[model samples]
Target chain A: MEIVVCIKQVPDVPTVRMDRERMTIIREGVESVINPLDYIALEAALELRQKAGGHVCIITMGPVQSEVALREALAVGADQAILLTDPDFAGADTLATSHVLARAIQKIEPFPDLILCGMQTTDSDTGHVGPQIAEELGLPQVCGVNEIHREGKFLVVKRLSDGFVDTVKVTLPTLLTVTKGLCPVRDLPLGALEAAFSTKDVLEWNMTDLDLKKEEVGFAGSATQVRRLRTPPPRGSGDIIEGPPDVLVGHLLRRLEALSILDEEDEKK
Target chain B: MRLEPTMKQAVIRRSVRKFSERRLIAAAVEMDKTEQFPWDIAEEMAGLQYFGLEIPATYGGAGLDSVSTAIVIEEISKANAAMGLCISVHNGVAASPVYLFGNAEQHRRFLNPLAQGKKIGTFCLTEPNAGSDASALETNAIRDGGDYILNGNKVFVTNGGISGINLIFAKTRADGKDLGFSVFIVESEREGLEKGPIEDLMGMRGNPVCPLSLRDCRIPLENRLGDEGGGLKIALSTLGGGRLGIAAQALGIAQASLDASIKYAKERRQFGKAICDFGAIQDLLAEVGTRIEASRLLTHRACDLREKGKKYTMESAMAKVYASEIAVEATRVGVQIHGGYGYTKAYPIERFYRDAKVCEIYEGTSEIQRVVIARELLKG
Candidate 1:
């Protein structure tokens, strides 16, 4: 059995900056850190591999610098790091990124049995790639996975959403978007840290390794454009009308009536 | 030169404190009641190159500087403060005389073996009548045809009862002058030389600061450390370097007290709340933490100065005075924070308090340090 955990490198949240004039993020001088959410995903993948006796390979798609995030996974006990770095993959949105990542996953030497990712990236806050990639691979996708257990060849996983819990059995080749609530991760002990820093065998791959066309990566691959960017205006400040339930209800009714949004019978209750 | 402990030295220093190789202590609490200096522990320290601290590797010592010596003392002191002082007195105070003033042959014979820890050494400067006054020695070493007949009684001599070599200070013949002192490396096995049992003290009880008496004891002329009447100079310089070590010792004590205080304050709860959360307790905790850090920095800086071959006498004196006083204050507060539990020996704060007081008294008392500081200041 094999597992592929997707990870990313993002600037530390506190130090992140946006270039207002250029309509982009300010990367220079920002301290890049391994995405915290991705650590949960990596932890999930490692645990699954450990329990099932399988190999865990970390697959990531970004520029050349993305190799750093991949290396971090390797240091935290990942079996290998697969980096999909190419100029053609620049500016690729979630849909494009998922497609390229799926291609890279297929190109891995031993392939994979399952795919894992964070519920969302801290910077983007877009929860689209996990589902998109699962759709592209024709594998069943599980999001907000709080508990995953191995039962024979299939996996019993608990997915929680909208305050509802669903226990599902998914066959091999499944994807999960993990949340921080899923599990707490830890930094490896000091002795292991020295060994991790000394060990180097992370696999660095490019478009050519996946037999990808140059036009299908980087700037050429991205489809949709992010043109004008600005924050939505702030909501208005309103008075805090505190009172007994009857009084508050009466006041609310008058405000709603003034706005012409209340019906007469509804106010009696 | 920027001096730091080599990796091997750091490991060895820790090993001694960690009790890596052998059982240095027979039992944890026996040394105090029986003021018996463990020759085995001394041999182990010598084997590990701690006995001859600051003696270069070429001279058979671990070749550590004053700073490295302080670090070693700190680690050892964490486990046993008395043993820490024992090493400090032997290496830093007793050994400094020969290392600073001895000739090439003297270096080869006395320093090399002492540094190698093969032959334990002691410095005999304090007498029944003289404690800090270097020039007021009553011991005499008159020239008697190729030899100096030594006759003297020195008290409060550290490692006095146990050490193999004694750097004895005595007055040589002079024209009715203020004790023209000269230092000699006295062997314990020599006839008519005797050492008394350990002196009982309120704290640092384990170190056997006893007596070294030269009752008609004769020594070879070559045993003299440096030149004629240079004993005072050698003793002062050696003691000046030793002051930095006391500062480091005080630093360790203060750190332990501060750590114990924080741990106690956080755990011990008062009426409905943890004591640490209280405004008054919080202030004590913060002050203790900050002062401990500041003292550690100053102490280590003074140690670094000694290692760099730069003159740090005044700075070391200041650090010794400040850190020692801080130790007393810090440990007292640590006991106070314990709110009654800290007063007992069951916890370390009380010992830390008792230990803190000695740092002020020894290695040129806090008053002496101020004198040295003011003198240095006035000279400029």
Candidate 2:
């Protein structure tokens, strides 16, 4: 069994500014960290591999600095790391990023039996890369997965849906986008970290290595482009209405009726 | 001539900061209130290899440099000074001597498990009679055929009760004429060893500081560290590095005080304006920030010297004195900035105030550090 985990590195600050003209984050002095939710996905993959006896591989697409994230994954027990970096891969949207990742997965020996990803990235927050990768790879995909376990050749996953959870069984060679509820990430051991930083085996690949055309990757292959970026306006402070319990309920109901949030006739019906 | 940390050091700082914020910060206040040793957190930190941050990889350590070790201590101390004290003692004074002076066999037997965090280690040089005048220790070890019969009482030992390995210093006589000191690696599970109850201290309450009593404790002669009469040299050398660890801890505490003060000053209102707008408060903040930065530079300079195998005795002493003093002053200002809230347990500044005092007293007192610096200067 071979498991693959997709991760990304993002600015570590709570709020980031974007360059509207370039449609990119102004990352001059901001520190980068592994996308926190991806740690949960990587933890899930590691746990699965630990039980089922398989190797865990981590893949990320970004600039050279993304290797820091890969080395961190290696420190936490990932067996292999592939860094997909190229000038052609720059400015790629989720669709092109997923395409390149799918191609890289195919290039791995003894192709992955399971692919795991964080449900969403903190930077992009689109939650589109995982499903898109699954579509590109033609594999069954499970998103918002909070729990996963291997049952022989199939995967039993618990997915969080609106108001309820759905337990689904998918056959082997499936993709899962895990939520933070999947599992808590363990601390990286010091010895493993020392080895990871010193080793030179982290494989770096480019578009040429993946056998992809320039037009089929990066910005040229992206289907959507960001036109503008701006911070949302600050929310107004709330008003507090003080009255007797019955009067307060009545006032709230009257306000809701005034705003057309509640249909009085429908309520009567 | 860059004073800032290198990229690798920055990475270490970031990683340690994340670890401390996630694991230590929440428990720090509660641990201080309850005065409980954080055994679970210690186990977790060991898994992270914080217990062996500077020891080599061959001994199950992080194989990091002295600067990296200092960075780890500083980050951890910023969150919880008590845990920081435990780590500083374990890595700096206790385990380092073995790695530095012990033979390969001793390293395999003692340093490996201690560095791996499989067993906690501590230094036992201070006794009832000896505090700063370490050579005046009353503990004695008598050679008795293939073993040494040891009898001693150690006080204020960090990680005392929980430690599995203890590096103890005792007076010995290879020849009847001369009174000399020797160091021994004594296992806690041995017979005739008694662990006293943990001390109720003013600060750094989470550290399990306790007294240890040994009566006729039998340690194999093979457990001796370095040659006979070389114990003082070993102790002094180990403490040179240990002083840097304490300096880092002090720097961390000082930084924490400044950080807390800044946040509180900005949020607190007085005279219909934020207190931070006042010139008095700004002066205090500016002074604290400058002193903390200066302390950090001194500590880092000592760490750099140690990394390059240069003699850092004077440098470490200077760093320890200045940084610990800065910690006390910064935390005091932190409390003053919080006004009445600082006196109460409602704020963390009170705890920082308590914790900062010990940095001046332990490792070496401010006066002792001054003496060391003076001695170094006069020698030239």
The C-alpha local distance difference test score for the whole of candidate 1 amounts to: 0.75
List, residue by residue over A120-144, the lDDT tens digit for candidate 2.
9888899999999999889999999
lDDT at position A57, candidate 2: 95
Each prediction's RMSD over C-alphas, in Å, is 14.2, 2.7
The model with the greatest TM-score is 2
Model 2 ranges with Cα > 4 A deviation: A257-269, B1-8, B189-197, B213-216, B377-380
DockQ score, prediction 1:
0.02
Please give, for residues B256-309, the per-residue lDDT of candidate 2 as tens digits. Answer: 999999999999999999999999999999999999999999999999999899
| Chain A TM-score values for every predicted structure, listed in order | 0.86, 0.91
lDDT of 1 by residue, A73-99 (tens): 665788877788777777787778887
Report the Cα lDDT for residue A110, model 2.
90
Colliding pairs, model 1: A88-A217, A88-A218, A89-A217, A89-A218, A90-A218
Note the Cα lDDT for every prediction shown. Answer: 0.75, 0.90
